[model samples]
Target: MRPWLRIKGVFVYLRAFFSFVLGGLAAGCATVGPDYAGPPATPLPAAFTRAGEPPEAPRVAAWWNQLGDPTLASLVERAFAANPSLAAAQARLLHVRDMSRTERANQMPRGGADLFYAHARLPSMSGGAEDGSQLPSRLDLYNVGFDATWEIDLFGGQRRAVEAAGASVQAAEANLADAQVSLAAEVAQLYVDLRGCQRREALNDDAIARQQRGLDLARRRREAGTASDLDLARLQGQLEATRADTGQLAAELDGYRNALAVLLGLPPGTLDDELAKPAPIPLPPTAVAVGDPTALLKNRPDIRAAERTLAARTAQIGQAQAARFPRLTLMGLIGIGGSHLSDLAHLDDFTALAAPRLRWNFLDFGRNAANVDKAEDMRNEAVSHYRAAVLAALRDAEDALARFRQRRVTVATLARAVEAARRAADLTRERERAGTTTMMDLLDAERTRISTEQRLASAETALTGDFVSLQKALGLGWAESPRH
Candidate 1:
C-alpha cells in the first residue's frame, strides 16, 4: 500500500479509537466507590456557659483590633509577614494547588513529539559460505514523529484523583489559616505578658519608694525615742523584699521582649527600645461575639482542615475501587525513516501506528481488593480524625470561656481590694498629719495598697490573656491577618 494510504488508515483507526474513549470520559459511567459526603455533624451546645453577655453581632475577622491595642496589632502584622512557620504553611498550600492542577490536567488528551536516530551493521549468516554468501551490511535509521496517548476514565479513576487533590488543596488552605490563628494568639499572649511584667515592675518600684519613706520616718522617731528599733528593722525588711521583686520583674520583662522579637522573626533586643516603657495591657470587651458551638465548629480552621482531609480520603476510596476495573488507553504514533536524506522525502519511508490498550489486574489474586480495603480503612480513620478535631475545638472554646469568666471575677476582686487599700492609706495619712496615728500605722497602710496594686496588675494581665485564648479557640482574626 502507498505510505499516504497507510498513514490514512492509521489516522482513521486512531480517530475512531480516541473518539470512543474521549466520549466515554466526557460522560463516563458512575465511579466505582461510594460518593463522598462530608463528615457527620457533631452535636453542639446551645450557648457557652461562661459567655457573660451575648455580643451585638458576630465577631469580625479582626478580633485582635477589638482589644484596642495598636502595638499588639502591629506586632501581629509583623509576625504574619515574617514568621517562618506561616511561610512554610503557605508554600504547602501552593504546592497542593499545583498538584490539583496537574491531576485535573490528566482528564485531557496528551501529545508530544519524539526524534530518534539509529545505526546498525548486519552480521554474516552463520551457515553461509565464507565467500560473501551474506555480506556484512551497515544501515543508519532516523525517524521523527508526534505521539499521543489518552487514558479514558471509563471508571472515573482520574476524576477521583483530581477530586482528592482538590480536597487536599482546601485542607492545605485550612492549615495555613490555622497557623495564622495560632500565631496571632501567641503574639498577643506574649505582648500581654510583657505589659504585665512592666506593670509589676512599676508597682514594685512604688512599694519600694513608699517603704523607704516609712523607714525614714521610723529613723526620725527612733532618734526621738518615739519608735522602737524593731519597727525600723521590720520596715527595712519590707523595703528589701519589694526591691527584690522589682529586680525579678525587670528580668521577666526583658525575657518577654526577647520572645516577642523571636516571634516576629527578629533577633533579640530588636524590640527592646520600642517596649522599654510600660504600657497598659489590652482589655477585652464585656460581651464576646462567641457564636454557638455549632457555628463555631464551622468556623474553626482545624476542624475545617480535618473535614477536608476526610473528603480527600473518601475520594481515595473511589480511586482505589476504580483500579479493580479495566483501564482503556488510546495511543497513536507517526514517524519517518530512510537510509539517505533524499530517501526521507519519499512517502514510502513514512510509518504510522495506532493501538487501543486495555489493562487490568484481574489475576492479582486479591491485591486490588486489599488496596480497596486499605483505602476504606484510611477513609474511616479520616472520619475519626475529623470527629476528634471537632471535639477538641469544642473543649478548647469551653475551657477558654470558663477561664475568662472566672478571671473577670478575680480581676474585679483585685480592683476592689486595691481601691479599698488606697482609701485606707489616705485615711491613715490624714490621721498621721492630725497626730492621731503613729508613723508605723501610716506605713503599714501604704504597704497594703502597693501590695494590692501588684495583685491587680497580674490579674488584669491574665484576663487579657484569656481573652486572646478564647478568640484563638473560636478561630477568629486570621481572615484579616496580614498575608505574605
Candidate 2:
C-alpha cells in the first residue's frame, strides 16, 4: 500500500474508534429529553362522608351482587361474556400486546435466508470464432447468496421505541378494564329498572281490584234507590280510569323486561317466559366508606390508562430525540442457498460467502428535527389530557356522593307519604260502609294510595341507581376479589 494511503487508513480507524466510544458514553451517561415523573398532586379528601359520620365500608368485588339477587348476578356475568362490544375491546387489548411484543423484537438481531437461479447466454471470447468480427466478448455467469441484518442500538433509540410500545400495551389493558366496569354498571342499572317495573305492576293490580269492588257497590246502592245517578256516574268514570292506568302500567312493565333482556344480550321478546313475575328490589346498605381520593389514581382503570399514555409519550420523546443523532446499523445475510436443487443441502458453500453491511444517513438533519418537535407536542397534549382526566374523575366521585345522599333522604320521605296515604284509604273504606261517604270517595282514596305506593317504589329504585353510580365513581368494581 502507498505510504500516504496507509496513514489515511490509520487515521480513519482512529476516528471510528473514538466515535464508537463517544456514542457509548452518550447512551450510558445521558438520555435526552425529560424523564417522566408522575402527574402533579392536587388537594384531595381523605375519605367520603355518609350520614354525617365516617362509615365502615366493606370492600366488595362483584358489587352488583350486593343487591342480593342471584338472577341479576347471572345476567351480568352472561352479558360480560356475550356482549360484542366488550369482546371487541378485549381483542383490541390482545392486538396491542402483540404489537408491543413485535416492537420489542425489532430492537434485536433478525435472521433470514435466500436462494437464486440464473441462465444467460453470452458471446465467446475466442478469436478463432467463424470470421470473428470486432465485437466485445460476453460470458455466462451464475451466483447465489444469503444475508441478515441487525441494528445496534447505539443511542438507545430502538430501546425507547420498545418502551413506548410497552406502555401503549398497558394503556390498552386498562381500557379493557374500564369497559368491564362500564358493562357491569349498565347491567346493574337495568336490573334495578326491571325491579321497579314489577313494583309498579303490583300497585296497578291492587288499584284495579279495589276500583272494581267500588263500582259493584255503587251499582247495588243505585238499584236500591239510595245512591244518586250523579254518584253512580262518578264511580263508573273513576273505575274506568283506574282500569286504563292498570293496562298502561302492565305495558310499561313489559317494556322494562324487554330492555333488560336486550342488555343481557338476549334476542328481543325473550324475557316474558323467565322474567314475568314481579320481583322486589333489595335495599342496599346506607353505610358506605369511600377511601382516600388519591387512591382513585391507582384503583380506577381510566386513571391508569391516562398514566400509561403519559409514560408512552415520555418514551416517545426519547425516540424522537435519538433520531437527531446518526443511526448505526449492523447487517449481514446468510442462507443455505444454491442454483442446483441438490446443492440446497450444501452448507459449506453457503458458509463461505456473506456480507456485513452498514448504512448511515448523513444528510436530512431537518427531517429528524421535525420528528422531535412533533413528539414534544404530543407529549404536551398527553400531559394535559392526563391532568384533565384526573380532575374529571374526582368530580364524578364527589357528584355521585352528593346525589346519593340527597336521594336517600327523598326515599325516606316518600316512604312516609305512602304510609299516610294507606291510612286514608282504609278510613275512606270504613266511611263508605257506614253511609257517611259515597263509593266515589272510597275509590279516590284507593287510587291515591296506589299512586303513592308507586311513587315510593320509584324513589326506592332511584336510590338503588344512585348507589350503583357511586360504586362506579369510586372505581371499586374491578377489585381482584368479590367485595361483598
TM-score of 2: 0.84
Off by over 4 Å in 2: 1-31, 49-60, 127-146, 246-248, 335-362, 434-437, 479-484
Q: Report the CA-based lDDT of candidate 2 relative to the real structure.
A: 0.74
Candidate 1: deviation at residue 339, Å? 1.9
The residue ranges of model 1 lying beyond 4 angstroms of the native Cα positions read 1-17, 24-28, 55-57, 125-136, 344-349, 480-484
Estimated TM-score per prediction?
A: 0.92, 0.84
**Clashes in model 1: which pairs?**
none
Model 1 superposed RMSD (Cα): 3.2
User: Quick one: best TM-score, which candidate?
Assistant: 1
